[model samples]
Target: MEISEMNLFGREHIKVFKNRPKAITEILSDGVQQFGEKVAVATEEHELTYKELDDLSSIAAANLQQAGIEKGDRVAAVIGNRHEFPIMVFACSKIGAIMVPINVKLAMEEIEYILGHSKPKVIIVEQEFTKKVRQAAEASGSLEAGSRLFEIEGENTFSSLLEQNAELTEAAISEEDGAFILYTSGTTGRPKGAVLSHINVIHSVMNYKYVFQTDDTMKTLIAVPMFHVTGLVGQLLHVLYVGGTVYSMKRYQNEAYIERILKDQINFLFNVPTIFIMMSTSEKFQNHSFDFVKKVAFGGSPIYQQTFNMLKQAFPNAQLHNAYGSTETTSPATLMPVSYPEAKVTSVGRPVAVADIKIMDSEGNECEPGESGELYIKGPMVVKEYWDNPEANLSSFTDGYWHSGDLGIMDDEGYIYIRDRKKDMINRAGEKIFSIEVEDVLKSHPDVVEAAVIGIPDPVFGEKVKAFVVGPSLDPDDFSMLKEHCRKSLAKFKVPEEFEIIESLPRNASGKILKNTLKQVGGEKNA
Candidate 1:
């Protein structure tokens, strides 16, 4: 089947199609119609097919109705990446209830902010987190006994709700209706919420199938957190669209991921570069034959060459795809072609089918080859706006295009090469510096384990480049050794003015650098 281009070649053209958005509910129903008995999800003890998933979510939907959840109302679920997540997400989508999947890793204060923002009618949680949920509820003054709490781990309690309501009410949702509010794991400022419409969800699902050539025979190993758009929209939602089975993991256990790939005969796998680095570096991942995994894709961060070398030696038969996307873009706008005889180890490829992406400089002017710039995406997949965040919406979207703050450059062939963000850049002594550029140059050194660069206050200079480095028992004040290494590679001003040797860099749960904290760790610096 031949495909028409999305209007990426023309200027100011947004593209067409997806007018009749079979809402998320309609998409799931279609999956059931085509592959009713095909397995849709599996855990250690429980398994379900398309038919079973539909029936189970229908029961949950009916229970939500009984609990007085109205259409277009927001609902919170305190759950992990287990099978329950997909079930609840689908149920909420079917009922036009905005699904707010709370990240289990956030602080109580962070969790409360989301609760206050959406003001969910009820909180669906498991027994494992009952105490935390109860505490949050009490603090929010939503401690009324009438409020519904659907506990998945409570056997008798959940069973009773299922028995009472086995039918689901169809939602009156338009293509423009909001389906989810995925809060960004913001490393710098407050977490901004991205509002995804029904059309955005459908658009991503269709794009996944179209770009990846997914089919019903495909089986996926989902290890990324379901709260993020990549796991929720790119992996789970796309699998449902293609009628594929899923082997779900609560967390990224290296052994479990390798075990599932070997034992379950999984075809496609989705995760971040961190997970891949862990897997490829682990000795256990080498013990198995992952020949069954046809497509192993990663996003969230740039992957290094060492890890790719390890994967090639371990699973040479598996094809590795580097994906570039984010929550606001509904996950994937670029489906990087698999690395060749040897992986390129860089270059995150061109835009996927159904996407229009370009790399623009700081002034919104298009960047030519070899020039780094911000990446912008415009298509059906881009979210309508941030949830009730007028300030963020005004700053993020420009003339129907979503400005992905990520910095990159497009080559002559249209392949994009990502650099550090413009905001993540540091200015020291009137000289510009990119943290990733400094970190990359530092990591290339034999002794360095990790490196993060930031600017610290200076009396003479406006700000000085300070590096927080992690290495195997090294001294930061060894200017003779460290400066020599930098002198061989980096420019004079880009080299760190001071260095602080630490065991590790402070990072958020999403594996992003907490540069603010690093900057605050300033005192009498050494170099």
Candidate 2:
């Protein structure tokens, strides 16, 4: 594979993968042609081979067309980790419909917001979330007179789509056509939909395939939500592109995850740091050998050094990688190269092959090495703009770069280090403090299982550091011990001024800590 420059999305001279699938539909066609009867995606109860996947998605596409879903129409799905979700993705792609995968874990109100915003012609949902989805559609006025709803297991169901006998018409879709509108995790404010085109997803999948050096033999367990870019594009689509197998879980549990990996001989593993941490610490995970796993990737939050060491011990033969990206970047902006040095584990590696990263200071000047600033990424993999939001498009994107809103520092070796989200950075009397740094230090303690840091209001310093620690049997003495532990590693001001021991931290479906929720908690505690 080579890199080449192309005029894309009305932009001149964007770097793109020279050899890649032209559209989302091409991924399935290539899989069918190459892998044929090989299993493409499977859940606990259902499995679909490459040939069956193609036929079923074609049938579903024809069914959608018969039901008034035309090209450029939005088809929203409230699907969990199941075979139907991926099937729907391909079905929408076949007809050039932009799929909107709404997070199943969201509350009714949140789902309503997404439904209202996307205004899909058809809504497909897993049976478990049908009631909520229907209520949301009704509340949001998305289920207009002509709109339709299909439950995964009901009278009007996803199965019916496969059963219908209709002609599957080939759609005229280009690499620049919209494929998906993934809603970002609304940790701060309302979630915005990042509209990804065919080229955006194709390049992202190619980046994963190229960087991991994966092939058709790759077997991945998709435990993350399919609504997210990590699970959908990074794992599922990436595997489909390489003609590999995908094993999906309805929900991730320690026992099920361990069992599936060992039973299926899963080789490629990509998940959040928290999941890896939980798996590494699980007693069940210790009794088995994970030598079969060849690649391990984690992100969504900073990885603690202790957790990294534990993962190394668990998967000795695995090439551990730290990846950093968001829905806006499709999935990966930076993926740690294979066989990365253990010392560089703290860094999130260099930018992906076609992507360029620049750290820009507050004044918009490019920062020098090791200088902290906002990370700006520009590439074909990056989405052109937020869906239908001109204001966000104007504010978040400049020139060809998307302002990531993430504070980062790139070392001389070109490795990127995420400090914190710009909103998460604390300005305590003009002394900058990144919550990830403090959280990483706190999680290094042997007893601490997880940690979240937020800025609390302070009249003198404007804001002060507050930490919520998760541990087993935490008490007053443990707090003192933890305070001393931080004192030795971090500066006095960087150390948390207030600490509260909680059982767990709140997180969104994407596995990112909800720091805004923490701020609310801090405010309530003070009140």
In Å, residue 208's CA in model 1 sits off its true spot by 2.6
User: Candidate 1: which stretches are off by over 4 Å?
Assistant: 1-13, 16-21, 143-147, 154-160, 164-166, 338-344, 446-449, 470-483, 501-505, 522-527
Q: Write candidate 2's Cα lDDT for 1-527 as tens digits.
A: 78999877666678898878789999999889999999999888899999999988999999999888999999999988888888899999999999999998889999999989988999998888888888999999987645699988886877888886888897999888999999998776788999999999999999998888889989999999988999999899999999999999989998889989999999999998889877876777989998888888998889778878888888888888899999999999999998777788888889998988999999989999999999999999999778888988889988788899999999998999999999999989999999999888888887888999999999899999998999887886777788899999999998888899888889888898888888999989976
Top candidate when judged by TM-score against the true structure: 2
Residue pairs clashing in model 1 are none
Q: Taking the tens digit of each residue's C-alpha lDDT, what string does model 1 give over 184-252?
A: 886767888888888778878876776677888888877777777887887888888888887778877
Candidate lDDT values, in order: 0.75, 0.90
lDDT of 1: 0.75
- Model 2, TM vs. native: 0.98
Per the 3 Å backbone cut-off, how many clashing residue pairs does candidate 2 have? Answer: 0
Ten consecutive residues with minimal summed lDDT in candidate 1?
2-11
Each model's backbone clash number: 0, 0
